[model samples]
Target: IKGKIKHFMWKCYSGILPVSCNLKSKGIQLDEICKTCGEAPETIEHLFFHCSKSMQIWTLAPVTWEGLQEDTQNFRGWWNKLCTMKASRMSDSRIEMTAHILWWIWKDRNWWVFQQLKRSAKEVVLLITLLNFILHLSYLNYSDSIFLSLILRFSLHNTHTHTSRPIVRCRATMDAAKSPPSYSLRSKKEPYLPTLQSDLKSRRASKADPNPLGVKTSGKPTDPSRRLRNRCTVSKKSRRRTWSFGYADPIHLKRLGMWLNLMIRKSYFNILNTNKLKSRKTTWIGIFVKGSRFPVAIPFATSWDNDVVLVKVSPRKHNVLAMFFVEITSAIFVCLFYRQCLPGSLSPKKAAGKIVLCFSGNGSRAGKGAEVKRARGAGLILADSETYGSLFLAEAHLLPATSVTYKDALKIYEYIQSTKNPTARIVPAKTRIPAKPAPFMTAFTSRGPNPIFPYILKPDITAPGLNILAAWSEVSGPTYFVDDHRFVKYNILSGTSMSTPHVAGALALLKAIHPDWSSAALRSALMTTADLIDNEGNPITDAYGKPADPFQYGSGHFNPTKAADPGLIYNASYTDYLLFLCSIGVHNLSFTKCPKNPPHPFNLNYPSLAIPNLNGTVTVVRTVTNVGCRGPGVYIASIQPPPGIFVKIRPSILNFSRAGEKKSFTITIKTEGGFTGTIEKGEYSFGWYKWSGDIHVVQSPMAVSIL
Candidate 1:
């Protein structure tokens, strides 16, 4: 029956099993001479499955097909009963395949003894191929019948590709839940047979993983409880990517360490490249500075370190330089790349509606003052020599030259202002040259030992000016070029002149926002609202670096943001001017004896009266008493007050310039009554200089009797 099973199950184990039978060495040869038994041979299975020593296996095979129909002698009858059993086609096929595989094992055992090339069934089963094949089959299907169909298909396809209805022989088959295959080989025969017990123990270990797909062959248990209990868990190590300077970039890795920016342009180039890296999420930021403008790079950088990000910034303007740094730390960190604070430059033409700035002597040589003067004059001439209507307003009145030169220049400027020549109008302004010869000062001439006034206040109101490394005009002389003999394309300059333009530029920005503001209005707003705080949030200082003396810093440094929002400004007018004059005690001139009504104070409403409340006034007076006419009515004085401030004179009008070459004007001032104050108790008097020109006062305001 076993032999028949092998022959019929040929298709199921086609490539896996051998054709011939060989179990004789075990003394279980099916037929050494079978001509008369009329029974088929008892081969491996006949010797085992039918033999009493192997009864347990047969009993386990199936109850009905165990041994009821025929005794061990009827091999043909056993075969018939096995094949006729009622079971699924796949079940029958699996049984057939298993039986054939056993036959192959028996054959291999014989070959090991004779052919000396065989391995035990268990050893061969343990081969990686058997397990791998079974796993592959499991992937395709997971039922008992699925394996049987696969076997049939394998055999039939191997032979003709179109075989149908192949006969299969099976002794008996049992139903078992589909599972991965397990095989055990029959090794050396056992001497003692133990009693058959029905009890079966599960082969799985306590730590075995329930998930077959995740099963590990390393023998480590994957049970959830075991995993939870194990304290020494291993975590996968994170991978890092690195990039070195001047090295070829690796294919798909981001840099791990910080990239140091050494070369100027190259450094910015790397920043730009890294910021725009393919598949990377980085920010694009840039900063550029002009050589002759502000130096915002290094000094500002003193407060920062390498880890702080700085994106690439190129000075787009001529005579400019920049730096760019990129952080490829991660997508999140890369976002900060563009936040680098970068300074930018603007030309006067480009700065319309924006603060316009121009610095003189930024390129002047001063060891030879004459040469410097000549150069300046030449430059000034060129400014007009340019196109017909250049609008570079002349601010010559504000130059920081000697007082005599400054005065002379003002006179010349007044002359020019009185003309209609198209070439004679530039913005009048103060020159903000720094003191000479200091390490960081401009090359202007030095001031006197104790000039009484030190100019060009320090920390010139934080403008976008720094060591503005910018593109210089390469066409210029080599002295202006870089050390490498490149074109004269960069420079560094200083002064309040440098600082002033920063304010002017900010003004341009404000102008762009509010175009209708008057010049005085704009100026007032800028001054009154400027920040009093230093860069470190400390109080701003005077030229002497002391806490803010008003004269030095004038209102304050120009505050762009604050200037934009000034709530109110002291708007001055021509009338306001007259009022200010009257308030300063410019009441009458008869005291100088030049004229009783000296030209009637051209721009005043009441040229002969006293300004109201002139106590805080700047004034002078002269008194002359009569030697003759010693009566009360002999002396009479009249006065007139100025307009706008409504200044009232006590005598209404004053007249007494010719009382013995010493005329006296009694001008009593009336404080604007509606005014409210502590009204500090005091008496007042006055004095005067000349009636028509510069004058000196003989006596201050005198205290009078109060009732």
Candidate 2:
């Protein structure tokens, strides 16, 4: 009740209501005089207190209000004083009554203005009193429940709907009981009537396959580049931030749910646009929240410049920034971790103020961001994860950091590798043309027939893991040396390690929402719902700008929205992992009991397909579980076999009728007879097998490594 009173008072203070005086002041040119009295303008003061009807109602109020009608030309000032009055501060009833009277007056005035309708002072007072009485009788938390219901009713009654056009807005009641957030979108275009749930299901399935599911009609897809082009306009304008922490922070925010604990501060949007204006002492950026009647701005005291030099780094063991600060020669570039190239190793001379090019998949964002700042480096160019490219960044980050797609990072890295010189520049966001697409693939994401097991695919999907900002541990310096104990709380980084968590987070969300789904089904959902193509509807590519193979992209880039409702899933069990270990000759890795007769590793029920030793032919078995809406998804297998590989799925037709229903099939990969090239010449080839059903196109990648 107190909250309601404050809200009513705030509305008057904000001056947003279409009162006659406010409208006239804004040049609305409507009738400026009060419609009921035609004697004075309908300002908050006149409408709420000075009006003859309001005066009469106040005179009859339960609480004494003899002073209100006197010197009441300014309602705002009078209300402020009244709020601080002892009666108002001490008695909730006083505040509630004031709000009730003000509400009735405004309500009556609106009725007169909109419909020339009148309710006698007596009747209006009765209604206000009745509402207040009911609120008083209700339980403490029950009023908000009533408010929600009332808001829903109000929307239905007042919202205008067009039969021919799509609704521009959608509302879904969120269930508090659900831990993982759910996504719901309703297209505002006309004549398309798919339910939100059905549309989401199909979208999830299409993310994994070329063919769309559940869609009734077929047409060319909208230009892929344009799908997210509007993002530029949607970028926030300010970096001013507040840090309020209570809820546990999530490293992987895969759902669209409101995060109660995190206070996100992003300065890149303004800093990246510094190229537009001449130099200034401070530049201002604004943060505008939807439905907010106010706008906010954050000021930065700097400019954006491309003089920032960039160099590639790859060593998982050392502080990359610190290494570059000391190494004045390019020979240090060959830093490798153990036997593999990591990010900690580097090469360069007097590289102070030069931005370093770092892989997204190599290290912790916190460690990287801290180290770079301390090293006095100009800036950092973080690329996306090796497996998933498309310049992925942490949604909101700290430090002077930016990113490029995996492919773009690859080109830059190659330029340095070949030319031995690193040249880098930052393009102002405002100067970016709408037509050109940034290359976003990374070249070096670890790919596999699972190093130890030829039948299992290692990477499940891709995400934005390049140049992302995350909270840093303040106890360590950017270099993280025992002697460097400079404490800070944020950093930036990229790599497979970063991308992996992204998928894991999305998986966590999927699990929270679909509590009944098995681990295998979830993995299948993530893979099958992944997009095999880039934004252009073409195959996903590698960092070199060439088309990528399954060995590089695994199942394809990750798509969490679609994974939520993947029409069907591939289910795996603990026994499956055990069998995989046994088949790979590493059964000793497990501590628990193992199945006496472990199935073949190829038959362990995984979401992906990998035939490492296709000497002549290999057969892998898998199972699909139904998880979509009503009715069976009658699907037929269609394969896009990797080059030089012939593939066949036995029992190609899978008809699933109910949720939890499982169907099994075998995929046989055979090498082409005439293709006699050495395994070393062309080690692997890629393609996909899709099960096209009426409502779902469940797809899986097929990687064939020539023996």
In model 2, where is the ten-residue run with the lowest total lDDT? 285-294
Candidate 1 CA-lDDT value = 0.26
Q: Encode model 1's per-residue lDDT on 511-621: one tens digit a residue.
A: 445443433344444544544455545555322234532222323445577666553332322222223223333322110112122322212221111122244432322
Please give each candidate's TM-score. 0.22, 0.43
Estimate the TM-score for candidate 1.
0.22
Model 2 Cα lDDT, one tens digit per residue, 255-278: 001111111111111112111221
Error of 2 at 634 (Å): 0.8
Q: RMSD in angstroms, all models?
A: 44.4, 23.2
| Whole-structure CA lDDT of model 2 | 0.47
**How far out, in Å, is residue 496 in model 1?**
2.4
Worst 10 residues of 1 by lDDT: 258-267
Off by over 4 Å in 1: 1-485, 488-490, 542-545, 572-707
Q: Which stretches in model 2 have alpha-carbon errors above 4 Å?
A: 1-439, 477-488, 587-597, 674-682
